[model samples]
Target: MSEQDFLRRLPEAGHSLRRRDRLQHRLHLDFTLLLLLALVAGYGLIVLYSANGQSMDGVQRQGIYFALAFAVMFVTAQVPPHLLRRLAPWAYAAGVALLVLVLVLGIGAKGAQRWLGIAGFRFQPSEVMKLAIPIMIAAYLGRRLMPPSLKHIVVSLALVLLPTVLIMLQPDLGTSLLVASSGLVVLFFAGLSWRYLLVAGVVIVASVWPLWQFVMHDYQKQRVLTLLDPEKDSLGSGWNIIQSKTAIGSGGYSGKGWLEGTQSQLDFLPEGHTDFIIAVLGEEFGFLGVMVLLALYCLIIARGLLIALRAQDSFSRLLAASITFTLFVYVFVNAGMVAGMLPVVGVPLPLVSQGGTAIVTLMAGFGLLMSIATERRRVSR
Candidate 1:
């Protein structure tokens, strides 16, 4: 071709390139899941603004967190599921190593040593385990048999219990439970036997006494006690539950309007910008707002499960299901605790709560779901 002819073709080439880029972008992102996530995160910012005494600081910071989270999600979605399967064991090992490092040179807040401070930035290693454990289990079991044989189930439980024990030792009951549940969800989805599940339930019931007596810390026990009777020490450890319940109850049907929550504004509700943010939503936006938020969550969960069902491999299916169930646990625990129906375990509401680590981790999970949803199986002639 002549140089002039090549030059003329360059514009057409550029147009084609732009078209391909748009197509690739569309293929790479899951619009339905993304929309649901954005809706919840946007609603979160609104609720957060009110919860933070109408201050923009919380909302502004959370917005930054959301941006970072979306970026992580996008990058993660670009990674193929096969690569993720290959990387799971390594990721899980690294996470467990970090947890060990935290135990050795950990930082404390309030009373628990659950964070590792690296060059002035603090992070909870337990958060990584929440995803890592499930990934590791899925990678391990997916390559093996379905409904995992007894031996595999034993191994899976060990994988879960090790991290759970470590995190519990960190005295972080909330995160430990979440991590444990993540691994268990993978096992369940992998087709663990019903008989095994029943036995496990009985064991859990039998272990509660020992867990409370030997495993739980004084404060942890106090939380359980407080859950039973918040009024027993209304001015002490019970104060949080009391105020949270009051905030939720006072919201009635329609809320008091944004920024007008008496409980949050008057500082009667603690952690209104974080763990108990749901109560703020309940108080300011009312019960209807809570339902809308829950509906968004349900849609996300439904989409995630649908993606899992359509996954081309067991790894994607198990990981997707585990991540989705973990999300359910997060929402359930946060809302239940705020409503005084469950013990306060410091679980932040999924994407709604103000936490960078949780946001990034969760978005990454969604990204993996997208990868599963969009991945096309290769065929050879």
Candidate 2:
């Protein structure tokens, strides 16, 4: 065109650039991570529609939850890391108090006392501990030196175990394991000694018998037994796993076409929209769809670790790593449980599973990662 036209647009272009800069630097948003999350969430909605019996109502409700979760993430990313560090202990204490209240005054459903109801709204307090435990341990150990002393290790274990035991008493094994894992991940990133890890492994192995005999409820033990030999009770304890495996295997490589899987579409598989949603993806989009979803997860996790490595302080580093790794555990456990490689523990498939509490909690962890990601830029200024 002409020099006059180019000159006329220069001011507007500069204004647009400045607006983008403000979003990145001032809002502390990670656009790459956000884009990847949106893709996954969008993909999840597609699968959830089919999984929930081709119902638009389920899709719309999930859409609402996703919108709310994104808002929570954006708000969480605006909080500075130092303020998060300062507030970590109080959050942990409040989480623990809520968990205790769950045991005392919580409502029970499906044989688990894991939810607290207020004003007709119910939520699982254990979900809060998933974030709080890591932040608490990271804040505590971040203040001390790396390769924490034995005294600090003991204190950290105490911090981890308190909420853990409380959750387990609610008889929710899956959440308790996740809660414990999140806190332990913080300890692992803190440069805890290999010897300590080995000892802990040994102790856990030795305690398995007691856990199974005394600690495990009947249904929990049945899950373990079913995992070993699902055929033992094909029509009973093994039905869910058997059906899930059938749905996944029938999809072949390229899937049976969306909303066409007999197992899910015919209602042969139970809980198709919740914990077993991945099976629906496998049955419809085939193995390729599952792989693509996992690839997105890998990208998001890589971004989180990159942020952790570049964090300005120990708290940010440890907390970021712990949050990211715990996400990995969630995906791993849910996929394994569905594939019959692990016992069914009711862990949802990250963003794929249709649930409000888990979606919000997972996004909030990513929000903290975003804050940690932009922390150096804030500090350098």
Candidate 3:
């Protein structure tokens, strides 16, 4: 009675598995990574609602950004890694051209000329460099040997610094540093020698003085001075950090309860929805909420590293690792600045910060990671 039914069901089960495989192959999605990203983005929307004074408007806008960002990720994942490698140099060239254009005819706001406007739309060229630099370096080095020779290293550094110097001229220090780091991460992943790294570290240490004296603007230097002694001018340049620290400390371990923090609600904490959003999370949901968000980030990063490790080619490995670690740097800088451990640099909290460009750029990076994650499967098939 059961033999014929079992045989018939076996074919149906096989068909279902085939369909699932086809879908995964077509989409090139890593479901686990996607789910983790969604969780963090959802958590961010919750915090944003409270941070923005319980306003639904900001939350709705951010939700729309997330939707668009996820779609970008999905479409990007569908692109083949080989195709990305092929496109890297062009992308890098275009980004550099845009950076030059920004300096020549960029829009200025709040004493910085960083955005290029066209047809009533404005965007940061530096943001494009964040992804471009890594991809370009990876593509260049991936074609050559591992542990790049001095010539390749020099070439890579040149590639990194050109855009960096341009962005710095725009006087947006945070983005310039981030753009530089993204390219350097590719070099690091390419197995640069320890001697080179040590020398570079020393050079950086030695250059700090000159960088401060000649390269750094007065306001940038002032930020450093403010970091050292925030109390000296608590009512002026120091106000932001002082208020941020106060909000974080007052939250204790369990927070002040969602949307109940006097610091944010009373409007003492400035930029609570943007660069200083972590302070809002600390004040509202407490330290526990911050840790939960970090845990999600750690999971996503681990998945990215796993993908990098599994990649069959050097381009995928280098690009994947660079994207993952660049994300870590973003989180580190934002949290450090907000907590007064580092000078205020306008780096936003990864997925949690309320911003349009950063969210899309970050998700596109995750898309690249997803493509690399699935490349091995496609190759094996």
Candidate 4:
């Protein structure tokens, strides 16, 4: 296909990404975002390579995943936002149905049963909710004739919470929290009332203690309690937190310098290639390295928000904002969990962690954001 014809796509189809517009803007080629993802993903490759200890397969596969994820990001960027909007409700429904199936036949791994196997492919339904809830809520609020009302806000919250409660039932606390945050962004962007926010806060506080006491599984409660002081149970439930802290604090300023990290090399911190990779970064890269990484993430998210601000339609605006904010939460939660400031939530570091599905999903979200930011539309900016 011709370049313009490729990127600027069909109207009814929603995608308008023509290959010709690939370099229409200077900002699209910014190195900060790529640098951040590369360093983090690079660290995953390093740690996974070592963690394998026997073969380089894990890291190699992850390298392939990174390449594929970036490719998806590129392709999605070429598509238009309206296309994604049309897909939102369908995506949400499919996500929920899949979650229900997981509740029935999900393969239990670690401490939760959240994945479904198809032939040789294994999928996590919770990941779908991460993307779906935001899109669904954004589309709903954006479609309102006027700014959303309390009733509309309540509906939005329900859209967010339904999946949260269901996922929590799977004991997938990490994903459930992420899904909640994703929905919150849409409500916030939709201009929800402060009264609603206050009410939600009160409800949260009222529920937390009871939830902690009764609703949370014993291990889940232990994670929260352990976050306060991992040393109290250093040898038991606190080991992960304590090790993560040690790895971070020991890095000081300039880091131990790649691959030279003793903690990661010794395999003291758990899930080095997955949830705890931030700990690996902290151990090897030190304080300065973290700053660099954070800067990159900030740039990427900021760019996404900028795109949302310029969106020609409310749905596109809300969706873009929610996606950007949720990306922020992913980095924040994972880093917080690894730094011992928060409990280990089993959340992967975006782009950096070694998970395949998360990499693809998050990259796809970025692509959609790029599409929203760049596409020419009928709606006013």
Clashes of each: 1, 0, 0, 12
Model 1 clash pairs are 147-191
- Model 1 Cα lDDT, one tens digit per residue, 1-381: 999999999999999988865565556777788899999999999888888888898889899989999999998888888899999989989998998888889998888899888798777888888889999999999999797899989898899988898988888889899999999999888877789989999999999999888888888899999999999999999999999989988999999989888999999988888999999999888999999999999999999999899888899899989989999999999988998899999999987788888899889888888878777532110
Clashing pairs in 2: none
Q: Which regions of candidate 1 are displaced past 4 Å?
A: 1-27, 377-381
Taking all chains together, each candidate's TM-score versus the true structure is 0.92, 0.95, 0.94, 0.87
Candidate 3 ranges beyond 4 A from true positions: 1-22
Error of 2 at 215 (Å): 0.4
Q: For model 2, what is the C-alpha lDDT against the true structure?
A: 0.93
What is the model-wide C-alpha lDDT for candidate 4?
0.79
Weakest ten-residue segment in model 1 by summed lDDT? 372-381
Best by lDDT: 2
> Which model, 2 or 3, shows the larger TM-score?
2
Rank candidates, TM-score, best first.
2, 3, 1, 4
What RMSD, rounded to one decimal, does every model reach? Answer: 6.4, 2.8, 2.8, 7.2
Q: Which stretches of candidate 2 lie above 4 Å from their native place? A: 1-22
Candidate 4 residue-wise lDDT, 276-314, digit = tens:
877777777789877877877887788788878888889
The superposed Cα distance between candidate 4 and the true structure at residue 150, in angstroms, equals 1.5
